[model samples]
Target: MFRFEDNKCYRMPAHFGGFDCPGPEAALYYKDAVSVTFTYTTDEKQLASYVPEGFELLRPELNISYSQFREIDWMAGGAYNLVQVSVPARFNGKRDQLEGQFILVVWENKTWPILGGREETGIPKIYADIEDLHTIQPNYYTSASYEGNTFLRLELLGAKPVNGQLLSEMQASAATINALGWRYIPKVGAPGADLSQPILYPQGAEVHSAWAGSGTVKWTQLSWEQNPGQWHIIKALAELPMLEMAPVIMAKGVIILKPNNGRVLE
Candidate 1:
């Protein structure tokens, strides 16, 4: 027999067939990552509906990133790729106090990470075909596609060691943003349930090494079944002006993610 509660299943001992957990371990630790951040202009009102209460849109710029992770703790130390789309927002209308970016969509190659990220952090993560290729020595390239439509592409031109001043500034910005948590809409199991409550995860990354470089980015519309909840995101992206073809911040480094016990901030 099985019982469903709080979006999780509880099976009776009699029904247990001596099977281990169906998902990965409680946490995943990434070893190394190479990433590029691209900033684009968009209409602020289009994103307003997605922004939760007590948070305000900080800028019209949207940040999209492509990252490749190696030596992940799970999957027997295998590698995977990830793509994220986010927007900057301020909390409590405080201009000086900038909160972390609100992630609109995240795509990964692995299933375990996608499941964990969606359930734990309320991240809108999905599994897709991700390709990470190295054409020339020290030059990395990546792309993500779904239903035969490629939606994202990235290329890292080159990377070099960072100076002390740049490293200090990066560290300071990381510290300041680390205090903020991500706000997202939770998946409801029952119909007519209270969907107004937002889920918040107190998570941030600690940058171990920072590199400076240049790169390129491109985005296209993804073809997928759109639910009512996803219409806002689709419309928002459509309203954005042409994104800059080049990345503003191209970095290759490693970081330790700090994802605390998640909770609802209602």
Candidate 2:
């Protein structure tokens, strides 16, 4: 149900791991990430808050439960904590002319501050480009509940699947009983919903579940634990007949637009 009508692009979450954010012009996917929740602006306003009004900022709806998010599934492995917001060029009205300086930057992972980093702040700094980002009309949303508070958005535009009809009856019951089609594992979050975020499965992992829809969901878990599952899906005819297995890709999108699946964003 979370389909804001292909507002265009900006699905990045795996910690801005892609879409190139090091420097030299990057950033080209932002289909209205909930308007970035209003680019951070609440300190005296009783801890900042906004429903609509922004350049970007919005990361606070977290409830938390699921074993306290399995103890740190918060995501953003590389690391990014820069706070140098300087936009006094007459924002909103657009003055001073540094391209009208309409700034708003934020990339929070507050490391599980409950749903940590709502829309992942603003994220436009690796030298800024993509037209300087600053727009939002429609994007997508619809996770009122998926068995476990649920809140996966590190990049999931035009996403589709609330329960996907009980996951198409669990992929037709694994294509009529095991022809195969269901291999995603190690994922648990059902209390108030903040499973430390970042558990979007499908990459080549081991453990987790809620509904891979008989689409062959497996991942038992061993090392890095939670989040970052497995997906090489080479050939399995979508998982069934002759079952080869190894080329799967229903892991949802936005990990900065595709950082080769097992990507830490990129």
Candidate 3:
């Protein structure tokens, strides 16, 4: 006989004992992280089309970021890279109205985080080979690909360190980072979802250092034969017009991912 515990987190192969569940306040530490972020203004209508019904597009700005995470506590001192694409938005639910960044897509080099994130937190995660952040002093570069076919590339140039006062100001402004996601679990052998809802994933970062710079991004128009399953996604993103470029930033910090603090939104 088997009994499920309310506090436990379970995934595939349920026959095996489920993994340990961290406390809600427990910190998932990401040490020695370096990230390059590029934000730019895009076509409002085009970006709005991707946002779901219950969400309101806050702006036409799109954010693309790449990071190399080292010595993650949950990964047991392992490392991984990821590319995250998001936009400013607000979630208007029956009982909850929240303003935050809504995730469009996340591509990770490893499968372990992808599985846990998608299944539990409802993050729209997929697999891609994210190259390590290549740096040559003031310049940094990285790219994402599948089966040797590159779909996206990001670069940061002439990055200069920002003073502590400015860093603190920036940190204070973004102290509460609410990441919104949509969880949709398809019914077994069906066209509809067994469970579909919006989720709130809270996170934070403690910046030890930071840099501000100019950035550029190139989104390849992936063909069906090249990306197969993800061609449409890449194509849509590729068509977004980068009407204006915003200031880019590079930061070295410790990221706190509070998965246990995650919850379903109205």
Candidate 4:
């Protein structure tokens, strides 16, 4: 349940710190905050030739199917990456050309799923290999449409929300990830235009953390530097069980086990 890829053909990595796009016109289009924004005119024909690939439609839907959720939890042993954010402001909502950067908030969630039998009613269910009471939190990512009148859609690979319940700021350590969604925050480019959501990760998910081990916090970027006594990895992979629903904005992180032999990477 752990592999993720962006619309443009780049695979997502664990522990995302930030992301950057680098094209020749990079500076011209991406000069504002690290973000994505698009302007839309009601001329149906304008987007007529628009083919929605990579990115999924940011529209009304609910719950991802059971088959679509395995993508977020497939990481190799000792395999980790970063989650980088770029606001379309980098280009001031312009689409001339763009380059993006992914910061280094590099924590890791290594998930592992097993084929558990059916439920009381006999519905197939996947069980996580973690302990009970492990909190499951959701991670959030967002992008805005920009000056090109281009509608930038986030291709949701997981389950869509069943009832518009946005858990962008959901708390808990998580046995699994939950519903993901996109908010409609206009990029007039202000604090109000910031629609990015935060997920409550288990403490010490990062190697160098500040919180004691349980805190709901947000930041501009993230990185991994082993500072054992400082960081905490409380949640286990067994917490997030697999469900059959394509959540739009959220995905399950690696079903991480308790860190015993894992060494800190630079």
**Which candidate has the highest lDDT of all?**
3
Off by over 4 Å in 2: 1-44, 49-91, 95-251, 257-266
Please say which candidate is ahead in lDDT: 1 or 4. Answer: 1
Better of 3 and 4 by lDDT: 3
Q: Estimate each model's TM-score.
A: 0.71, 0.16, 0.96, 0.17
| Model 1 pairs whose backbones collide | none
Highest TM-score: give the candidate number: 3
Cα lDDT of model 4 by residue, 11-39, tens digit: 12433432342342221111111111111
Output the worst ten-in-a-row residue range by lDDT, candidate 3.
13-22
Global lDDT of model 2: 0.22
Give candidate 4's total backbone clashes: 90
In candidate 3, which residue pairs get closer than 3 Å at backbone N, Cα or C atoms, i.e. clash?
A: none
Task: Give candidate 1 regions above 4 Å deviation.
Answer: 1-28, 93-98, 133-139, 158-161, 175-196, 206-215, 222-239, 243-247
From the highest lDDT down, the ranking of the candidates is: 3, 1, 2, 4
- The CA lDDT at 149 in model 1 is 57
Residue 212's lDDT within candidate 4 is: 12
Candidate 4 is scored at a TM of 0.17
- Candidates ranked, most accurate by TM-score first: 3, 1, 4, 2
Q: What TM-score does prediction 2 earn? A: 0.16
Q: Name the runs in model 3 displaced over 4 angstroms.
A: 1-7
The candidate 1 region of ten consecutive residues with least summed lDDT is 175-184
Candidate 3 residue lDDT tens string, 15-52: 57676777779868898788788999999999999998
